[model samples]
Each structure stands twice: as C-alpha cells, then as structure tokens.
Target: MLWTLRSPSVRHLQPCLARKLSFTPNSRLPRITKDAVREIPPSTSFREQVARSAAPKSFTSEIKTPPVRNQVIVFLVGSFAVYSIAAEQCNVETAKWTKKLSGSSLIWKVREPTSEELRKAKRLELGRKLQAGLSSLKDMTEGWSQTMRGLAVWSYIQVFQPILDAGDGKRTCWAIGGVNTLVWAAWQVPKFQPFMMKHFAHNPLSGISYTLLTSMFSHRSFLHLLFNCMALASFGKSSGVAASVHLMKEQAKNPHGIQETDVTWHFLAFYMSAGLFSGMTSHVMTSKVLYPRMIARLTSKAKPVDAAAVAKTSETITETSEKTILPSLGASGAIYAAVTLTALAFPHTEIALMIPPSFPIPIQWGVGGIVALDVIGALRGWRFFDHWAHLGGAAFGAWYYNYGPHMWNSVRATHLEASQKVQRPEKTD
Candidate 1:
C-alpha cells in the first residue's frame, strides 16, 4: 500500500520537476518580454514638451487672459494737462507782448486788441509774407544749374509752394506730413524694416508707450502718406476759419468770435491726443476680445493627437499675434478725427474723391459712409485696417467738436487771469 501511494505522488512531482527544468535562467530572470519590461521612451527636454503641447485647447486652458491697463484714461488726462500747459505758455508770451506795447511803466492793465485792429495786422503780415516768399524764390533759383533749377522748381511747385501758400494751420499740417514722409522713406530701406516695425509701428502686444506717439507720424506706403496729407491739408484749418470744408460755419457768422492766433500748439495737441486714444482703443480690443477668439479658432482647428501639428499651430499663433496683429502704423486714426470734425463742423460742405475723381458729394454723406463702413468692418472682423481705432477717433472728434471750443476758451481765460495777476503792479502806501 505504501509503495503504490508513493509512486503516484512521485509521478505528480516528476511532471512538476520537468516543467521547472524546461524554463531557463534567462526566462526566469524577469522574462524580457515586450509586455513584461517597461521600454524607456527617447529622452525629450521640458521645453520641447511645452512647445509641442501648444494645442489651442491646452494653451487656452494654461494661459489666463492677460490683464490690460487703462491706458485710455491716462491718455485723456495727459492730453488735457498738455493742452493747459501750452495755453499757459501762450498767455505768458501774450502778456510779454502787451507789456512791451504799453510803452509806459505806469500802464499795468493789459490792453485787449480790437477785432478790426487784429484783422488789419493780419492783412499787413500777409503782405509782408508774400513779399518775402517772392524774394526767397527769386534768390533760390538764381544760382542753380539747369537740371537742379528744374528739379528745385518742380519740388517747390509740387511740395513747398503749397506749404508756403497755406495758412498757419495748413502749414503746420504740411510740416507734420514732412515728418511722415521721412518715416515712410525710412521704411523703404531693407535693413531698417525690423527697426521700423519694432519702434515706429504700434504693436499692441509689445506693451510700449512711446510707439503710440511715434506711430502717428509713420506710414509705410507712398499712397498712404499722400492720402493722409491731402485730407489733412483739406480739413486742418484753425477753428473759426475757412478750409476745404467750411468748418464752424456758426463761428464764421460771428466775425468777432473769429480771433485768429497761432493754432500750431492746439493742432499738435489734438492730433497727438486722437492718436493716443485710438491706439489705446485698438490695444484694448485686440487684447481683450480678438486674441481669445483667435486662440479659440486655432484650438478648434488643431489636432491634439499629433505633436507636429500642435507645434505648427503654436507657431501660427505666434506669427498671427506678432506679425499680423501687432504692426499697426499710420496716421489714419488722427486723420479720421480731423475728417469727422470737419464733417460735423460744416455739415453742408461738399468733398470730391481723388481716386475715382468723383463729383463733389456732401461732406456729411462721405463721413457717414466711411464711418458706417468701419462699423461693418469691425463687426465682420476685417483685418486690413484697425476699424476700432477709426471708430475711436471718430468718437473723439465728435466729442471734441461739441466741447472743445468751450474748453479751449476756459483754458485761455484761466491763463489770461493768472497772467494779468502776475503783471499787476503792487499798490504802494
């Protein structure tokens, strides 16, 4: 009985022993099977992971919307401050002139000039200017070679002659156009493109402050410069004066209200203010609204499973924001302000288009059409021009047209009072 039981147990044990003997040491040592061992993936750097993971969905989730500051408020406040300071300086100069003209130490009170006297003086000054301009033209042409003379004459006729013929306000606009031409010329050079785009163009993404001002005088194309200069020349007359559009017709009706002073300071202040306001508007819209939408679109289009696709999507986002969105440079915004102001100031005035050489259309109609077009463009997401900026400028111009003259008068009055106080003689016992 013991032999039989032992034999059965040994038979079972022999099978188990055979199986164990069949397995080699290599097979027993963690069996290096594909599923048994964890294969090491190729080493990738952290930056590469981040760069490759820029799928719109992941990127949007990772990046919170950037905080934008209230640059518009700052620009508005600074504009007023600059205007006040300029008015004060002008009053100070006027006070000095008044004192000089008094010709008596006992005369402490400032004498306000009659409108008739001012008109006579302006006429006399105009005569003197014409005489001087003629003399200079004769002298300039006398010593030039034939080719040089022809070039100079052509330049003067096409450029300098109009500037010379323009009034104080229009002349100032021409000077500004000269600056724009210089910037445009700089844009023509191959090497300067990068520098020009970086410094002269207003890139909302760059977070630069000075570019707001610099970009107002920047134009990349000749047609752009020509159009802007033409508009500026047409509309950029001093308030209460005649221009391409009959601005401030109500003021024109009241001859006494049309006190002509040098409007250089005022025009400069308005132009800069409009440009800054418009730039800030564009910046805010781009940062707050357009950028997120862009990211969303990009994300929707990207394939998350493909690493290469993700990387390409990221590169496209960078290029769109940096190259396409950022480089807004022109005087269009400021010129829009001038245009709207002219339209509102002279509602019945007519203007002719240069491109098509169309017959003169009502100024109000032209402004309305352009503004409406801009509104539609903004709504439809047109990328050719900064429509928001144009709208902002238009709004500013409208606001200024209503309140600007009163504000200017208030500034002048305040400065004039302060000046009178300074010039007043102290009573002696």
Candidate 2:
C-alpha cells in the first residue's frame, strides 16, 4: 500500500530488503485516495479572489475614526447658519413700517410718529419755507441773489457752529459772493433751485475779461454758493486765520516788519479767484471751436439711419466733444482751494463733509486729487468739467500758503518806510 505522510518528512533507512514491497490485500493500514491528494486549480470565483487579495486581519479588530472631510463640512454649515440668522434678525429690526428709506430700496425702521417728531418735522418744513421767504426778501434788499445768500449763510452756520458765532472772513466772503453770483449770473443753479441762466453779455467795447475781482460772483445756482460757503467755513475757518496769525507773530520779532492784514488778504483772494477761475475755465472751453460741434449735436433733432455713417459720425462727435464742449460750473474749485490751504496749514486735523452724506474724504487727498484731476482733464481736452479752474484755484491756494508771510512782511516794511518818511522830524528843508 502507498501512504502519504501528513507530518514533517523524515529520512528512514529500512533494512535493505526487496526494493519494492507490496502489502497484503487484507492489510489493516489506511490507504490514501488519489482524489483527496490531487492538486486543485486556484479558486477563480469572485468571493475566493476577494478573500485571497484581502490582508490578514487580527481578531482584536479595528476601531473606525471620524472622517476629516465630514468634520470640515459640518463646521462650515454651522457658521453659515449663524450668519443667516443674524442677518435676518437685523433686517427684521431695521424694516420700516412707513416704507420709505430715503432714495434707496433698503428697509429702515419705522418709528411711530411721536408728537415731538411731528413737531420737529413741521418745524423743519416751516423753517425751510421761512428761509426761502427770507432769502427772497434779502435778495430784494441786497439787489442781488438774496435767496442764495441765505443758503450760504445757513451752510456757514452748519459748518462753523463748532468754532464760534464768528467763524472766518473768507467764508463770509464766499457766502457773499455766492449770493451775488446767484442774483447776477444764474447759469449754474441745480434743478432744485432757480435756473435763470446768464445770457450772452458784454460791454460794447473792451468788455469785462473776468480777471476782474467782481467776477467771483458768477455761479448758476444758490446751492453752489452754499457748498462753497460750507467748505470755507469747515476748512478755512480752522486754518487760514490761525496760520496768518501764527506767521504774523513769528515775523514780528524779525528785522523786517510784517503786517497781519497783508497776510490775511489772500484769504479774500482765494475766495474770489477760485470762483472766477472756475467760471473762466468753463467759458474758455465753451468758446473753443470744437465746442460748437457738441452743442450742435446736442441741439439737433433728426437721427441718422446708416449704421456705418452713424458710427463714424459718433466717433467724430466724441473726438470733437472731448476737444471742446466743457463748462466748469459750481463752487467746487473754491471749496477745494479752502480745503488745500486748510490741509497745508493744519496737517493733522480731521475734516467732515456733508455733500454726499455719511462719508468724509481726507482734506489733503480730496483737495490735491481734485486739482490733479482738473489738470488731467484740461490737458486731455476732456469735455466733462472745467478742470482749468480747479487747477487754478488749487495753485493759487498753494502759492498763497507758501508765500503769504513774505508778502505780508514786504508790505509792512513798505508801510513802515512810508509812515516814517511822512512823520520825519524835518527842520529847515
């Protein structure tokens, strides 16, 4: 009988009997079946393949961990929920019952109209009416624009209420000039105010060149005057006077005497020149050859039908318009001058503006930027605004700030020399 060893193989040397021995048919030893010992092909079924490829696992088993990806997603979702809830709550509280949020669409709180609120609202409305009526009356008295003057006065009050009852001389001049301009030349007034525009006007021969000091009062609207006055009060009042005084005191101890009145004169010049410069810049641009093209186009009635022709025409018109057709209106030039002077004189002071509401630009940046932009606009032949006036006003302000002290000292010296000569102790001449 043939037997297969299931244990480790051992080398056995049986007595060297016959090489091949056969067991008796009735031997008790168990026989190994060929089927059980036969090799079987690798189990290629899905289950068996998967089992073979799998790594050996310990019986202790593995403990699963929290997924990192899942943790991040959960955190983001939670944060979003908090933000959404906060926004909703704020919106709910801010919602207006009356349904008016100025000129915008945002919801604002509707406060129950209290008696005091009603009274205040009524007073404000009445005050505006009274101001209007008073301005008209004042206009009659002044023989110029009394209404615009009132607005300028109000603006000054608003801006300089913080300083004192008496604020600045330049601001006062600006207010006066604005009133004069509104009544005298009415081309720059906004729609909300009167629009009696200035017509073609000049003396018969050698007409006013606008270089005249009186030309400062030439704005089109009362509002223009108001804005300039406000700027002057806010900026000029704080700095111009203080700087003039400081400079005057400093020069008092010097060999060459200085005059406070001489230094203070530029305050008047700044107010007057800024307005005149802006108007002159606009006038010059308007009078340019190409400006007539823009005016003609703007005033024309019929539209061109040809696409190619229209395109070419539009390009020409744009080029021509940019080359001319600019009118510099408004008191922004003057206001910017005041702002520049104020910034140069008081480098660290903060300024507030009420023009756009809720936001204030820095004085230095605001003044310098306007001047620079005007210069660029003028150089580029832009047709949108009067950049020349802006540059002129700002330049005047800078020059005045730097040289005012010296000029004042020179004037004082001249005055001293004249007075001493006049008061000379002369004997027999």
Candidate 3:
C-alpha cells in the first residue's frame, strides 16, 4: 500500500528553504534556528502557520533590508562604548554589570545564565582584575600633578551637579552641581594646590611615600571641564570627592597612611617609572642578546621622553649623559591608570570610544587589549601616545590596591602607638 505525503515543504523545510520563500534575493535566514518556530500542535494547521511566521521579521521590509542581529550587536556595542568613554574620560563611574542569579539545585531553582550573560560575566571578572592592577600604578605619578588631578576632578564634579539639575530651567535639576564642580575645578587650580600639598605629605619613619591628593580638581581645558560636568550630571557628582575626603580624614588620624606626602613624589615616580619601564622593555627587545648590566642601566635612566629619544641616539649611555633630559607633564599617566581601573572594575561592561563609536568592545577585553597594546608600546616605544605611562599607571593602581588594606592597618597601628604615647606622662627635661 502506498502512503500519501501531507506536504513536502513541512519535512523539507530547512533555513535553506527560507530562501525560496523570501522576497528579496540575497537576503534570507542564515541559520535554521529553533527560535523561529512557536507551537506545532497535532490539531493545528502547522504548514500554513510555518509559512506565515517564516516570513522575515521586518519593521519595514519593502523600504529596507530589515534589521538583523548584527545591527543589534552594533547598536549595543556603540552606545555602550560612548557612554563608557565619556563617563570614564570625565572621571564618573559607569555601569558595567547586570544582576544575576546562579546555582545548581531545582529546589533552590536558579536562573540559568544565557550565552550572552555568561560571556559578559567572564569579561567583567577579567576587567576587574586589570583595573585593580592599574590603580597600583598611581604610585608612579608626580606629587603636584596628582594633586592638580584631584582638584580638576572635584571641580568638574561640582560643575556637573548643578548642570544636571538645572533641567532647561524647568524640572528640578540634579546635574547642576556636577557642572558647577567642573567649573570650579577648571578655574581654581592654584587655590586647590596649596590645600592638596598640606594634606597629603608622606611619613618620615615608616618608609611610606606621600603626594597631594587633590588631583580631584584638574582639567586640560574648558572643553574637558564642560564634558566632565555634563557626565557628572548623570552619575552622582560626589563619588571621587567622597573617596578623597575619606583619604584626607584618615591621613589626619594616621600620619603614615596610604594617601601620600611630598605631593609630587608618587606622581613623579609614576612618570619616570613609565618612561623607564618603556625604555627597558624596548631595549630588551632590540638588544636580543641579554646582558643584565645593560638592562639595569636602561631602567635607571627611564624617563618617558628619553625612552623615546634614546632610539635616535646610540643605545649606549654613560651615567653622565642621563642628567639633561626634560621631565614631562599632564594627567595622561594617571588617566591611563584610571582607564584601566574602570575597565577592570566593570569588565563585562561595554565601551564606546569617541571620534568613531560605530561599535563597543566588551570592557574586560577592552582592558586586556589596551594593556596588551601598552605592553607592545613599551617594547616598541611607539610615539603615538605614552604607552609606558599607561602601563606604569596601571601597574601602580594595582599595587596600591593590593597594599591598601595593609597600608591602612599600618596606619592604624601607628595611630594607636602615638595615642598611647600622648596619654603617657611626658618625661621632665
């Protein structure tokens, strides 16, 4: 007996089948995805339903080639990147993680992570580590510049708060203060510096170093201030301020605390170290054949500019030749460190760059990529930007973070010792 076929299209339908059904010639479903199908009940007219829904999901099919997942990917990445860079550039904290639930028990039923979710989480974890590493690098920044940086940051925040709340002169504006903060940070650099220096000096006894912490108020220009203020409107204007104040209070309590004294020392250290590391890395690569003395010599004279300048001069440098090079300026060193910090803090977070934000990169990968790039820069001594500074700052940030808890403990112990000494009767002269 011969059985009659219901419809060849039903069994024969693959994503390849969508091609014949699709109206446009070069466009059809590429994957035979299960998501395209709904219910396939026994009583239902399954064949006709599949044909109808199988029609491409379109917003305006005739007018355009309809949006695809690729478009969605691009949009998500681009928007995320712009927000990330803008927020980071201005020193505001940006979003990076999503709330998630994970577990193995059905009785304790947990939300299973989708592929995108898992991918993002892994990226976030990686970013967090790198960012911490960057914080360790601040140890390398010079004192005055770091203080200037703090002032600039605070000023931007102050401007930002008021601007955010001004609300086109209508709604109760939250961003107004942030705008004010930026304005203050930009114009009042000198005033903030004295305060910065007074508060952040290093310990004489504990081998602890110090630098001014008011870099909270520095900005490169009016544009920098303006943009930072705008960003402060969205994120709370008080983030870095709170951190700075807390450090200051702690310093007052424990003179040997982690913040710093000789406000220019750490910043200067970072600047020189970055250049030095960059030069050393570069020398090692070119020298090919290893010599320990040569490496140490290169490292000792490692100013960022000399690292760059050394390439043109003879690779050989005597001790006498190192003294003449000029020192560099700018917050780029610490900024690079901060960039890495934000990247690691929110690795799963997305980033969109300025100039061209066609897409966003995952924060974790972004941090890795930038750090990797900096490493390559150190070795090659690229002239584009100070890759060594970036690496140096990142390294400093990580070190500081690791030492943060321990440093605080040391400060507390010193405080206790001093307090007991104060309570004890003074010896008569």
Candidate 4:
C-alpha cells in the first residue's frame, strides 16, 4: 500500500518531510517523485517517526508577544508632565522648610540663601539623621554575634554612611542603586527567576509600560549593578551644584542658579526621564524595525547548508531569542545619560576606567570613546548590550544639558508665584 504525505499513517512525518522537501507551511508543495517517496522506510513505526521529527523545546514559545502599539509620544508627554508636577511640589516644600528653619518669611523675599549656606544646612541635617540611624543599628545588633555585628557595621559604613556624607545628587544615586541591588538579589532565587523576568525585565514585545521604568532598576548580575552604580555615583557627584562650581569655577554661569536648597527632585526627574526614553528607544527599534526584519528572514526560503549559512542562521535565532523573546534589564541606559552629561558639563575633568585600570584620561575623550563603541555595536548588530538604549540615553543627556536648566527654572518660578499667591491674604472689600 502506497502512503500519501497526508495519510494518517504518515501524519507524524509531515514536518520532517516538509523540512526535507524544502517547503514551508505557506509555500506550494512540490511534487514527490517515485524515488523520493520510496526513500521513507515502509516498516518505520509512527512512534519512531515522531521521535525522529521532534526537536528540543525552547523557552521562546512560552513567552507571549502582546499587540504592538505606538506609545513613544504618550510616554514622553505623560512622564515629563509628571516630572514637572513633582518638581513644583518639591520646590514648594523646600521653600516651606527654608522658612521654618530661618524663622523669617523675609528670607524668601529679602535674600535667598547662597549655595554654600544650603549645602551646610543639608550636611548638618544629614549628619544628625545618620547618627540617629547608627545608634539605632548599634542597639539592635548588640545581642548578635561579634562577627555579625562587625559585618553589619562595616556594611553600614561602606554603604549608608557614605550616601549620607555625599551631596544630594550622589545620595539619590545610591538610593537608586540600593533598589537595583534588591532587584538583583531577587533574581538569584531559582523560583523567583520567572517572576522577576516577567515583571522586572522589559520586553519590547510585551507591550507593557511599567516594565520600561521597572527594568531601569533591575540588574540581573552583581557586576552589572556594581559598574552601573559606580558610574552613577561618579557622574552624580560631578554634576552636583557644589562640585560643578568647584570644577568649573564659574558659578556666575551656572544655569541651575545659586539656590541649591534641594535638587533631589530635579535629579530624580532627569534620571527617570532618561531611563524611560532609553527603554522606549529600544522598544521601538526592536518592535518596529528589527523584530519584523528578523521574522521575515526566519520565514524566508531555506538556504543551502554551509558553514556561513549555518552561522548566520544561528546568530539570527540567537538575536531574536535574546532581544525579542528574552527581556532586557539594567540601569546602563540611565547611567549612560549621566556619563555623557558629566563629560559635556565638565570637559576638563579626567576619568579612569574601572575595568581595565587605565590611566586618567580626559572625560570628553572617555565618553566619546564609549559612545563610539556603542555606535559600532548598534550598527554591527552586537547582541551583548542594548546599544540603542544607550545611544538614546546619551542623546537625551546632551539635549537636557543644554535646555533642562531653563525649563526647570521656568517651572519653579511659576509654581513659586502660585504658592505665594495662595499664601497671600485676600483683599478685604
């Protein structure tokens, strides 16, 4: 009895046969010659056929791709609006605190505190808070093992103490770094891996908005967290009001103004904006451009088996799996923004590479080199890092370095005026 390709007896062999016959599901079926039909052994059992055709399952199939939507404009507009509102609130609160501490409403109108005065006040307040925290920790750890106590103290000094001592910019960086560390720790649990990947990692195909922000604080590896945190700290410190004045020696030209009362909100706003922009950039490039190109190549006509062909095919599949299917997570994009901004703001500053232990090089050169590498990686389709995101962040940093200060000043002035109006007594008729 002859066995047709679609016969029940050979139904299990269709995929294998189709692959062997060089025909895809959507392609026209080629005529099977007598010789080709006889190549299948008549005695081959259905079980054996099924076994031969089966390949190892991949995690790709388990991940569901959500419907694509263009969210670039919406995300940018919404995020910036939120940032503006938060900045206004922070400015008002800072004004209130200044009034309370000085015991004089005249300070706001007569003479605002200088940056030096603000810095001293900030440091004193932080010192008191740090002392209180340390005392509490000492009491709590008194009963613990000596080793544990020593470790706890060491960790506190190494982490929290420095964060408190540093300027508000660096303090904010450490706070973000702390969150990243927690996320990294969570990823180490075997059972938590799946959940973390789904929630913490940003998948372009996932069509989720929250992950774009969440992934900024999600570092999968200790080294990644360490490097990014280190970079953030360096840039944050360099960009601080005090540090910039010291480095530039031109406080008169500083666009951030002399009122260094509280820039925590401003820095936080910039960081979040950079992260969202970078994440969106990666998402659009993958979902709108690279992803479609990948699918087309994957479904196109089969090529002959050769070394180059096999290698290219493997690379394509791997890229698709890593970028499109598997999610991307880390703080590199936001850090890149900081790095570029610092480089441009303080062009005379020197920086040394942490990984290679390079001698101090001008920051401009260092940032330029880093950005060039990213450009090359993006153009060459390097799969190790999300180069598009890095580039996006760098672009935002440069752009903001020029215009962000003016925009922030405008927002603060508007809010301050409104706040004063509210506080003013209404005229009696």
**Judged by lDDT, which candidate is best?**
4
Q: On TM-score, who's better, 3 or 4? A: 4
Local distance difference test values of all predictions, in order: 0.71, 0.48, 0.39, 0.74
What tens-digit string does per-residue lDDT give for candidate 3 at 102-196? 44335324544432344345445545664564444444333548677567555655754443333221111132334335534544577665453
The order of the candidates by lDDT, greatest first, is 4, 1, 2, 3
Error of 4 at 4 (Å): 75
Q: In model 2, which residue pairs have backbone atoms overlapping below 3 Å?
A: 139-146, 188-220, 189-220, 189-221
Residue lDDT tens for model 2, 236-273: 54234343334434444445522122223434434554
TM-score of 4: 0.70
Order of candidates by TM-score, top first? 1, 4, 2, 3
Best model number under TM-score: 1
Q: Which candidate model has the greater TM-score, 1 or 4? A: 1
Alpha carbon lDDT of residue 134, candidate 3? 42
lDDT of 3: 0.39
TM-score of each: 0.71, 0.43, 0.31, 0.70
RMSD value for candidate 4: 18.5
Off by over 4 Å in 3: 1-327, 423-429
Error at 176, model 4, angstroms: 0.7
Q: After the best TM-score superposition of candidate 2, give how far the Cα of residue 242 lies from its true spot, in angstroms.
A: 7.2
Candidate closer to the true structure by TM-score (higher is better), 1 or 2: 1
Output the lDDT of residue 125, model 1.
63
